[model samples]
Target chain A: MVKAVINGIPIEVEEGVTILDAARKAQINIPTLCKHPDLTSSASCGICVVKLKKNNRMFRACCTPIEEGMEIITHDPEIIEIRRTVVELILSNHPNDCLKCGRNNNCELQKLVADFGIREEHFDKFVRDIPKDSSTGTIVLEASKCIKCGRCVDVCQNMQDVWALSFLERGIHTRISPAGDIKLADSPCVRCGQCSEHCPTGAIFEFDETSKVWEGLMDPEKYCVVQIAPAVRVSIGESFGFQPGVNLTKKTYALLRRLGFKAVFDTSFGADVTIMEEASEFVERFVHKKGTLPLITTCCPAWVDFMEKFHPDMIDHFSSCKSPHEIMGVLSKTYFAREKKIDPEKVFMVSIMPCTAKKYEITRTDEMFASGYQDIDVVLTTRELARMVKQAGLDFAQLPEEEPDHVLGDYTGGGVIFGATGGVMEAALRTAYYLVTEKQFPKVEFENVRGLKGVKETSIKIDDTKVNIAIAHGLSNVEYVLNKIREAKKNNQPMPYHFIEVMACPGGCVGGGGQPYGVTDAIRTLRSKGLYAHDDAMKLRCSHDNPFVQKLYNEFLGKPLGKRSHELLHTDYKARPVYRK
Target chain B: METSVVPDIANVVEKWKDKKGNLIMILHEIQNQYGYVPREISFQLSKLLDVPLARIYEVLTFYNYFKLKPPGKYTVSVCMGTACYLKGAPELLEELHHILGIKEGETTKDGMFQLEIVRCLGCCGLAPVVKIGNKIYGGLKRSDIVNLLSQYSKEGAPVAQPV
Candidate 1:
């Protein structure tokens, strides 16, 4: 342990702990812009500098390790002045139109400027004239607002292993862009939006589509309906001043009704249906040997895009089931519209998702149009939903708890847990075990396939049959899993596992690229715990036990993977070139 | 979009295939052979190295030396060193720009001459020097640029050696 005195508060921390962390332990606030809890510190911003008494040298607290007996003055008059100057310099290059920015009041740099009492620009304003790139249609690249923090680049290249973004030039000329100065849509971007999630400013953000939803809502002819994803229920509370893990599922349904939606549904219901289709598919493949082993889940659109581009060879292994929201969209248009005697063309379906990639997934293939119209008309991120709620002048916290529309809103514990990493595997296994052994498993909860680990491996036995399963989240962690499979295939070795799940974001949808900002592991765990807690409190914990899903299957779709289910619930994949021609 | 690799570039890739820091080394070889890196070659290299095209472009763009396009047949380098700048080199550069119809580091429309601003050519004594191809012209006036460039523009013109 290393002992340090931060602002006269003596604290002891681990040897390799940064001074910033040490000061944090001592309750000394050292402001940082470039350093995020989820990313390694690049120390690009000078705001976290602290004064050392022993050597009398100012060091960047974020990157410097705390030494024994080191007297660190994290906040002195001189240090404040220096930090204030740094903020001013950053402001000089940044556009002062904060109100027009998407980040606006939530920007870290803006927060620092306000905290430092910066009233005016001290230096001449010299903002770059880079035009925004919205080619991907999922995230926008407003390069002019970037402060060269390197967080987005780090997340994109190192964390995600999607080298679609990089520091193209050097020094003042340096800007984050795709390799070859190509449009992001043409680049190997997977539309994951992690870059936007990691960005400290509005330089990277989800392409706002709230106005489009408003247009649909205001149109008297359009029957606008909205559905909330499983992750959004736990995550959207952060924007309304609630803790990260607070479940606001009921409140959100009430809030959406207040916003003038004709009907509100739950994507968890769609997740339950997905499990019905996916679990049966697994049984058909694993039991009957009809398809390839190690059926990789394709619920996360980002993971699907990544597979289509990087690991196209594994296309055969990917499950043909559509994502939960997409399933909800198609069903809402076809079944809901037909049952209610409403025109399918007038049914404008919007999905409130914790993912930016869902925006792209809505129109990914012809299967998305299986309802004879665009299944999902609009997709709003959890952050965007928060904005829409605020715009509607509704106090989300004070909203009365309510239930979703009964026809397609009810969900099971298996459905709700789909928000977290290894959740889909657990959910699938619950139903797959039943499908295989013709009996409900003794324990519904699979403890092994849980948590924020990048790669999770476990095996479950159904009677005498042992089923090997592997779950991986975050795109970078996927390479290791793929390589192992590749090596086995090359050497004619036995297949590693019977099932695999991949979510592009680290902690699944809870840590999605479009969730509330300032997300760390603590926040992700809390948000995931919220879903798990919701699961535990539920009476029906398995997907097959979801009565509404069973009702849908009985009333409309004959059975899982039947002609009707195949038409609406399942989709296909094709190999795609990473870059545009 | 051309997936077919040139034999020369393939040879270059094979030569540096086993070595570390081979990307830059192979890029240097390609640049030397073709005078500048081509888009097609970069695509081929990206496929050969199993590296992302963005990574190769990042490295190519970061360094001032690498060029992404083919250079002109002749390069007209105006020395912009302190000595040359003090000796009316800017006017000489302007004259060349006017005559060639191209900016610094850009080739002419006809692909005949490329204009560039260079630093000290180790001939400070001969300030306001202009180097065209291998030959250096010292003590030059703004008016002399048009005449000097005309000598290289004509088809099958005999180029003078360095003096």
Candidate 2:
């Protein structure tokens, strides 16, 4: 361990640790715009500059390694001024249209300005003729508000390993955007929202369907059904001024009801169906040698798109099943509509998701309901829905707790965990373990697979068979696993893992692209907490235990992978066009 | 949402009172028909899809890949994957940016070129490759960009239809 003093506070940290990391460990506040925990620290923005008093030297805290007995001045007047000047230069080219921008209070650049008290404009700002790009249909790119901070580029390249964006042009014309300055959609963005998730300004944002959802509420003839993902309950509360880890599913459901949704459904129900279909598919894949060995979960759209567009050879590995939200959407139209006898056409199935990728998932053409209608109508991020709830003048906190409507509402704890990283793997393991052994797991919590680390791998023997499973949340992590897979193939080695679980955004659907814009690592813990809390609070915690799902199989589905089940539940994946460049 | 991926425009309008999913299908139709979603097409489809223009606009801007304008005859894209980026892909894009005099996703003034950057083309071996329509140009250099673009059209003119 290395010992160091930062801002006069002493601390011990691991070797090769940066001064910024050491300062963070000592509870010292060293500001940074270019340093993300998961990114390769570039120290480009120069905002984390600190003076090493002993050596009488200054260095970027993000890149500088902490030495023994090193004394640092983090907030010296000269340092503050230098940092402020750097920020001023960044602001000089940025658009000051904060009020009109979508990321008003949620912008990182704005947050930095707020933190430093740079209220008065110290520099002239430029207004570009470039309007925002909405082509992606899943994100908003208002280049006018960009600070040219390469954090987005860093995350896209170093973290997610997608690298669709870059720093183009130099000097005042300098801009951070996708390659060739082309709109994002025409590229293989996969709509991960990590770039927007890490963007410090409203330059990028999730597509807003609040207005359409509001219209749905006002439509007298439409039966508006809303579904909330498990991660939303924890994160949405923050937008309402609540602290992280505060689970408020009941209140959120009640508030959705107050917002005029005809019926409120929990995405956990769809998650339950996902486990059933997924586990059954796994069984078939093993027993019948059908599909790929160790079928991967397709619940996360970001991962699905990544596999489809970039790794078409691995498409066979992805489970040919719709995500939980899409499954719920189909159920709402086919079953709920038939039950209500309302023209299925009049039912507006609005999915309140925690993912930005859900916006893209609903657009797949090969999926059914294409003969003329979209099954899943619209999607709003948890934050957007909270805004709508507040826009309606309701006190979200004080609203009396209400239960989700029956049937579509109730879900097991296993299903609820589908929102968190490694959740699908754990959920599938919980059921698969029992299905193989016909006995309960000695340990229900698969501690091996759960955590904040982007990727995790484990091998457990189930039913005298070694089941190797891998779970990855962020794109970077998934890329690492794929690289390993390729290396193994090159060496003519046996594939070690049987199943892989990947989410587009780090930490899974709870830490999704469309969630509230608190893109901090802090938000991941909070959202995952919300997901697990909901899981722990639920009565039925196993996929097979959902009585309603059992009834679904007996009365409707007829059995997992049955002709009727395939007709209603399963879907295929397409080898999406790989725009080779 | 009519519980369909693509809904008939007339049926959607007749059921417009609550036809929530019509806009998605309409947007898909527009995107499928054109190489990209043009803003004008979205405006027209908004009425047919029964979606408000502002709402359609919001959806268009949210996703990274959706475009709001006309694309070009031959879409030239560079793979910006990490393997590509480390191998001078960004610099190659800079070269194209200079040669094309337009950023990614924009049509040339004459509507003959559209330059873009995709995530990964799954060609780790050909790190600095560019794709023009279905043709892939491998092992590119900054100097070869102008001549590379000449294959599509003359310096400033649109590529006239071969027919």
Best by lDDT: 1
lDDT of 1 at A77: 88
For model 2, the stretches where C-alpha displacement exceeds 4 angstroms are A1-15, A24-27, A54-56, A368-372, A437-439, A483-494, B1-163
Q: Write the per-residue lDDT of candidate 1 for residues A1-581, one digit (tens) a residue.
A: 88778888889999999998888888778899999998889999898988987676999999999888999888878889999999999998898789999899899998998898988776998888888999999999999899999999889888888889988877777888987667899989999899889899999999999999999999999998999999999989899899999999999999999999989999999999999999999999999999998899999999999999999999999999999999999999988998899999999999999999999999999999999999999999999999999999999899999999967899999999999999999999999999988899999989999998899999999778899999999899999998889999999999989999999999999999999999899999999999999999999999999988888989999999999999888899999988884
Q: Score residue A295 of candidate 1 by CA lDDT.
A: 93
State the TM-score of the second chain for every model.
0.87, 0.77
lDDT of 1 by residue, B5-114 (tens): 36478888999999999999999999998888887788889999998777898889889898876798888899999999999999998888787888987898888888
Evaluated on chain B only, candidate 1 has a TM-score of: 0.87
Q: Report clash pairs, candidate 1.
A: A179-B54
- TM-score, cand. 2 vs. native: 0.76
DockQ of 1: 0.68
Q: For each candidate, what is the lDDT?
A: 0.91, 0.77
Residue B134: error of model 2 in Å? 38
Native-to-model Cα distance after best TM-score fit, residue A178 in candidate 1, in Å: 1.0
Task: Give the range where candidate 2 chain A is weakest over 10 consecutive residues by summed lDDT.
Answer: A364-373
